[model samples]
Target chain A: MTTTEKIRGLILKVAKGKLSQEALKPEARLSEELGLDSLAQSELLVLAEDSFGIKFTHDEVWTVATIGQMVEVIDSRLAAK
Target chain B: MRQSAGILGTGACLPEQVLTNLELAERFGVTPDWIFERTGIVQRHIAAPEQACSDLAIAAARQAMENAATAPEEIGMVIVATITGDYTTPATAAIVQGVLGIPAVACFDLSAACSGFVYGMIVGSHAISCGFCNKVLVVGSEVLSRFTNQTDRDSAILFGDGAGAVVLGGVPEGYGLLATDAGTCGTEYQAIIIPAGGSRLPPSAETIAAHLHYSHMDGNQVFMFAMRVLGNSTLRTIEKAGLSLDDISLIIPHQANRRIIEAAAGRMELPLSKIVINLEQIGNTSSASIPIALHGVLTDGRIRHGDRLVLTGFGGGVSWGSALIRWHSPGSDQIHKKEKNDDNN
Candidate 1:
């Protein structure tokens, strides 16, 4: 799957029943727009790591703010590999 | 004239099945010793599949009444503190009252999590002091084992099932409850809670699939919150009672974990010996921990008449409370004579 598609899929999965495809826009803030709090955001990161087989550092968690930003980071990591 | 409602009697009941740390560790993919070192929980009781929270509450309530030599008819109210109830409609306290045949007493459940018993004590004491009730039965009961996820090490090892109760009756001057403080911070409710199974997210097959029925917690945040609140509540209660820390002969804290208790005690400059620690045997019985510890201490003869005691607790809803009580018992001779005289009648 493309990086954008992967990130989008992971967000939906972690949202549980709270968010849906219609609600998630590329630029939407996860906490404010999507209603994922700090704990939920951390859980999403864990789920993404497990699904994509990539490990994230503390810095990366902060650096990747939006879905699009997350996709770019994952794409760069995939290119480096 | 202010009437004082002293703790007339106390009792606790643990389920027959015990789950040890070693057994739980194997299931959760963690080291038994690590669990012990972190929480100091060695074993915990698990209710039988057939038993519910009310069953345990009833048993403990019966024991408390028996010890107090008080009949059900004399109880003016019943307050059960628990998060896990048999159902969402009828309060568990009502069910317990029905089972015990104390229909006249007003009954309801309170949801302050681990601090519940102390909260209940405060409420019951207030009712008696205001002459609203002459006798009150306050209980903290939970069947947390039924709601805990066996595979989740963070929570599974930290909870167990049990119930504890205390009977409160009017005392003479210079005795009974002295002061109480209770507070809640709903803004941090997400720190520890069951994610679903409420009006916000009604239970469904989807919720079930997501494991929303089980307890979820952020251990690190809860740990920080507990330490701060435990110390704050204790200090507030002591001050409110117009006494210093030195006046407190015992500190009955909720048995969430040993580290939390130790950290709070360190902050207050209190010795560990004065604090009651029973989490090793029963884990975190939530609301039941305080009364269970109270019963344990009383049964062991560690607490005596005229001793000053401070009870405190903190838990989910980020709720916390503390109460200062002076121990005073109606003379055993009077109790014996009353029983003998009653038998003759």
Candidate 2:
């Protein structure tokens, strides 16, 4: 699968299918468009960490916004190590 | 092959006085529901004016000895885990040793904040496994009510006074501690701290006026740190033991907040029914949380011989730890079964 496909899969899983098709766009804001709260974001980060075996710090997690941004951050974290 | 040390028995002591959330709400000018919503605390025990941390520790230690059928002379060490010890000069374990008349036994104390009990188990287990001692008494005792700012709702509502203890001795190899892990992030040292009364900022009239003696917490930061570390350390410890998640029967986490534990459990994919929680009855007893909860669950027979239980906690050193223990109560031993049967009759 492509990077976009993998990222979309994670977003869907973390959001519990709450994200609409339109919200799947790379530029869609995660919190504003999909209503993921802080706790949900933390859980999402945990899922990402476990799935990819890559960790993100608290500051890195807070800066995440769009689904595209989360994918980029995960990619960067995975690459950094 | 390392000798294995497991908990022989457990005991706990909470102060007689009960302070309900309604009472604290009246004092703090917040509704009881508001307090409950945030902290999940119903009532907490407060130490009396005459009571010290050692007083509670002695009571708890005695009970643990009785339960373990361990004579005072057989215990080669007494280790106390606490921040609110009886005195800063003489270790609180030394005081307990004196009171129990267990002469010449090694005694000391260590500070790991709320994670003290987990840390104690690691040390006590090592002591027995290394043949440094035949038996060890490990106690987590705290008089947090004394350090709490009566008017600071953030911390006052979260602390209580209590102690819990366990007798540690050899269990059959392979049925005791499987794995243990611990870590400290000193960079976050100030996440939960009392700014004064240490050598760096010794007590003074000015400090008292400033109320620098009371505990302070960065609640948001601590919550995030707690949720992240609690599950991570537990899973890591379990994996290190060469066991999978399916092998775990119970998880006794630090009884800090219901939401923090629940959130971490969700992240870890562990069910709520598998976790032990007692903060509603005792509030946050800091180092005493895990042992008191352990004692509670053990008393009610929620745990049994050969059951694998994970004990995990995080606290004020910016510290956290986990220890995997296969339960082995003394009463379950064949040598004690006859005595236990007679006593039951």
| Highest-scoring model, TM-score | 2
TM-score of chain B of 2: 0.96
State the lDDT of candidate 2 residue by residue for B1-345, as single tens digits.
Answer: 678899987889999998899998999898998788677899899999999999999999998888888889989999999999989979999999998988698899989998888898999999999989989999999999999998888888889999999999998988778899999999989989999999999999999999999899877568778888998999999999999878888999988887678878877788888899898989999888888998888776677678899999898979999999988757424325544665898
In terms of TM-score, how similar is model 2 to the real structure? 0.84
* Candidate of highest lDDT: 2
For all candidates, the clash counts are 0, 0
Error of 2 at A35 (Å): 12
Q: For candidate 1, what is the DockQ-based docking class?
A: incorrect
Q: After superposition, how far is residue B334 of candidate 1 from its true place, in Å?
A: 13
User: Candidate 1: which pairs clash?
Assistant: none
Which lDDT tens digits does candidate 1 get at residues B1-345?
Answer: 989888988879999999998898888787888788678899999999999999999999998888788888989999999999888979999999998889567899988998889889989988999989899999999999977987788888889999999999898777888888899989889988898899999999998898888999877567657766887888888898889988889999999988778766654567888899998989999999999898888766677678889889899998999888898864332234445666798
